[model samples]
Target: MARLDRGSVSGAACGPDMPAIEVRSLSFAYPGADAAVLEGLDWSVPQGAFELLVGGTGSGKSTLLSLLKPEIAPAGERTGDARVLGENVADMDVRASAERVGYVFQDPENQIVCETVWHEMAFGLENLGVSRDEMRRRVAETSYFFGLEDWLHRDTDTLSGGRKQLLSLAAVLALRPRVLLLDEPTSQLDPVAEKNFLHALFRVNRELGCTVVVATHQPRPMLEYATRAYRIEGGCICKVADIASLGHREELFSGEVSGWGASRRAKNGVFSSASGQLDSLGPRGGAPGAKKGLKSGKSAEFEVQILSQDDSGVPSRVGGGRILQKMHGGSATTLSEGWFRYDRAAGWVLRGLDVTFSAGAVHAIVGGNGCGKSTMLSVLAKTAKLQRGRMVRGAASAALLPQNPKALLVAETVRGELMEWASTCGYDEDAAQERAAQLGLDGLDARHPYDLSGGQRQLLALAKLLLIGPELLLLDEPTKGLDLANRRIIARALCEHAQAGGTVIMATHDLDFAEQVADDIAMMFDGEIACMEPPTDFFADNVFYRA
Candidate 1:
């Protein structure tokens, strides 16, 4: 777990002046694609430095990161020289590359190779034919370093998204790679979990002397520690003169009028309130008048409590379009005294919870990681049955977009995924392409579903669900990996869904998205709904849950 003493790991010269990663004239195009995603790029990273890559969805950030680790690099017509720790990426020895270069996938679950935490940590080492004693030492050291000792024996599936991601980082560090590459590592994490993970990653770069490179749309959290930054634009990588300038480029991710009544600023990517909105959380399980309005804050005035950004007045909806038809306003579904747990031996996830979702509103479940938000969605989706609760649904049709959007993707081609459910969803190929265009996925019909950026893939999955014309829509982390522009697109889509008399219940860690799009916001804490209210009333006077 310790590699801090390396003079240099790049090139033949073991000197501090050497670069850990270097790229020259790198151009790549996926098979059967229209053009190259990356073209004629030249870049370099200092040894043992922390670096960041900034780009929007489908902008080739993922492709650039993939090229760093040649073993799993995507299939394509590639022309370039990419070197990691002094060795050409394309010509790396299989064993040597696996030991020297570490890559963490955007989806934490995508890279996990074992059922249990212990096995996963050892899996990579086992492949390298590491000595038994050395593997045990590394495992124990890393487990303690990442605070994973508590769940060493737990099944990987039992861990929350945050925990799984942390474990992934720990497992990779167990190999003591000279350089680490992470793609949107904190996309699924809650605020608190993200801070913790960043701290750990920082230690790897500072204390352990491992070169770190991360690609992310959300760069605020990593800006403080980044030694350099590169942005991919028009199939080329451009070095940024001042990394701090990225924080001020609000237009990069957040400049569209929200579909809902309010606006969300993606600059800070954290929620905190100077106003005392906690007082409005009346009573116990929920705020007063919780059920009075399906669209909670159509007329109420709420003060903004910003941590860094200015209190710009609320924005207005620009486009007025409807994707769904309005149905009779009534209860979409009701969960009465819901009680559920994944395993009888495991702790209860939903404890005697009761709530009603109206037919024409966007309701968001906001909470910390591992607070049973996703589980509640599963119970509602019927993917996970509640042990002792009644789910009464008035709507005949419904659809679910899971936390991991790739779960529902069953087809090899992007067009095929849309066509797979065209018959069942009451939509044809043209409608499918139209829906895809609405979510910024129009030109990717020929690519495989797995090849898209994390955010693009999310939109594709959501397009499938929306095409179903479901009256009851369930989404988990609906905007997990999206940039602000895509977030705006999705916000409008949810607005259309609600405007059409459909009901949406989504679990998310993005409070900004919730503030701008959600009509009703519910705070889930420790297997219970701690409070529920409109965005104005919910975030106003609130002291925590913000950065």
Candidate 2:
């Protein structure tokens, strides 16, 4: 039956009082581990309800979600029961289980399998043996719903981080599963894209009666859609009467970091932790070089208000703001572009773009999805040269921290992965261990890189790049998967890098991080730098990227 036609499952899953999912006394631990990551956990989600699950970086949010879906559950010693639709998930028929329970992984990379957007959208339908007519109908409806018609034929590999995330969700939702499990579904999305996705997800729960359980570090975006929330803490789940009522201090940050201009003093690598101590979740704050007050709302009277520079190329208008402002001016052509795109027929991802960054300052590039931020970084890092136009660089030693942290992780153990370049980079075990401690990787040295949490892998990849000690660093969404505390860890690392005379440039949708750490906030649009200013002036005057 068609999902829109059927409305809801109406039977076992949609029964008024039936638990769509139930867990009791469940425990899970990786092989040869000291103790269980989760223990004696009891949780349940009712039919037709929208549930939010919030936790820290490695607090087992992904692990629990994977366990709920039997096929992809991690290898580990397990105990107790995890049931779905009144059937023990481990014993249920694989195909039936997959069709009924749809899972959208935390990382978009984990969910997308096909090369093209259209193929990915129909991949699930084909597996379920849907008729060709039905598959085409579902694909058409979902693409239009997602506003993906413009790029339905586009290659999935070329899509931006936020776009890839949208494709992943659209693909799973095409199948119209009875119960949907999502992990940080909007982590990569920009402000507008995030809002649209949340609206669509809400419809899926309300119109389709699909039970939704989302695990996120930042929960502010979906608070309105959430009916009730449960927090994963200390190996068990605790119900929170009000997700929005909890203050930033107590909510375990509950998914992604909040506070638009929230910041901390980065001094001697001693940035204050909002999450109690180093190894846990906390309110990530601003660095000494971070801008404190970030404003929002669009300005109708918007024009380019570029910061002027003196004859020596130092910024002429450094304010007495709360953070340190670097002086290097237009001479810092952090992003110098002419004209470029992936294909001859495709529109330019970079065209007539020029932005400067100080030699020893941290800069952030903010833009909507597919605004050529990643392409610009790729060109600057010399990973991909611009096809048509000039891109000037510092000729200093450089390294790039990719949006996908897994790209850098190759070895089996965390320590092994970080030390993979010890011989060539002159990095010793002692230095590697110290670097790990600095970034809060203290107890995870022996674990495999893939075995670590999404945020952990993000940090691990960054650690690998920092070990090589490049004079110039290019980061593509460094904080995409981090929790509040780990966000602070990354901020401190970048600030320290800049203070050590290394240049830092990052592309991100995180307004908070851009304000907190970047000396200059540059906004990209239609493959060019529409405007550039210091954090304060940038956030104050921008029309599109104010969030």
Candidate 3:
């Protein structure tokens, strides 16, 4: 067991007492890795304070979170001490540490272990050996707090990404841990749900007095609730000024909090930017107003161009191009009177939805969780069959990137993953490397896919998808866990793809990414397309949908 004996450091801002968590001279390196992930890091987290960890992909934020818990801490070479609640974390028993510190993983699907929401919430209590009556009371309270009552009896698999994540949080909180650690818990959620989840955390901290620490790439919304913020870079954690003191700095408000360019000293206070490299994309045009072209009041439409060129200088007769000519004379795909559901007993997920996706355009489907956005994308990609209605596909072939990036990763190494896709697509090794570089995945060739950060895994998946060169590209939550820099790179890549006469349909909760990249926006509601229009009109007309 390692312990640190150091005098209290100033500027803790937690409370005038021993910090909830303290680390001194901490350094760690994974087995077989060449360089240390964390180097001589010193950090203090105040009791009952909401702390946020911000960094680019692979900056060791998740690794730091893992070290906070003894039960699940990664196997690594380490030096120095980490204390949780005045006790050496390394010395604590796994079960005891777990009782005091609850961790929620980034992937909710991976974290959930029970069949139903009720069972999931009660699992932790059962492990702790709580009496049946006490377990029921705790589970009931947590489920209500998280608004899971309606679906408490539903199968875990039936819930949406957002709901599953909420369930995961509720399950952890059921244990009543004093310290809560979350690693990008909202990475799979939409903007509205993300805001809601953060608010819930704020309540947990304010009402329950639980110390909260979250690691996230998207930190703008959470910033207002954060008492302190830290940036991880160069294998160390540097404390930044509180979010309140930063004021209306556009960079801070713009969701680009992954360390502004380079670190610099501040004289009076901590200064940081919410802006990122992608800020240069400039402002978009258009105003909020009623749009034409929809008779069903349930759907909306936008005009987009399809650009195609080949050896014969004629559009290739495959994928979106082939489907375009037949559907709407030039559109990529059309869904008329579409109805779908996972199971007949589950009821309809998409109800009489009518929508047309333009060819050679970047189209985004925006909606709340479980609104059939993903289901519609699946139908377009030909992954899901339309239970009822007609889907006319102009595309001879298409590529779909599922919400879970790990599903697409089959190769041992990043380079091998891209090469495999290239080989299947009849492209050379150089082409794969070029595409990888386009997505900012240039130097990660030798790294294992699973070893990469969540954002990096997403980028690798995008690289593979792009290498296939499908006419129509379907992406689900493409920018979920990515930093602003990588988001900008992906936005640029998607725009270039559209310019080359390719089609892109992305179902995402990232309004910023959609605003920056999509030419048209479709808002899905209650298993139907509530409206579709230019980004400006769509956001303006719907007050709640605006980010």
Estimate candidate 3's alpha-carbon lDDT, on a 0 to 1 scale. Answer: 0.73
Whole-model lDDT, model 2: 0.74
Give the TM-score (vs. native) of candidate 1. Answer: 0.85
The C-alpha stretches of model 1 lying farther than 4 A from their native spots are: 1-13, 248-324
* lDDT (CA) per prediction: 0.76, 0.74, 0.73
Q: Give model 3's clash tally.
A: 13
Off by over 4 Å in 3: 1-16, 242-311, 314-330
Q: Identify the leading candidate in terms of TM-score.
A: 1
Higher-ranked by lDDT: 2 or 3: 2
Which digits, one per residue and each the tens of the lDDT, describe model 2 over residues 378-417? 8888888778767667635688888788878889898898
Quick one: ranking by lDDT, best first?
A: 1, 2, 3
In terms of lDDT, which candidate is stronger, 1 or 3? 1
Which candidate has the top score in lDDT?
1
Worst 10 residues of 1 by lDDT: 299-308
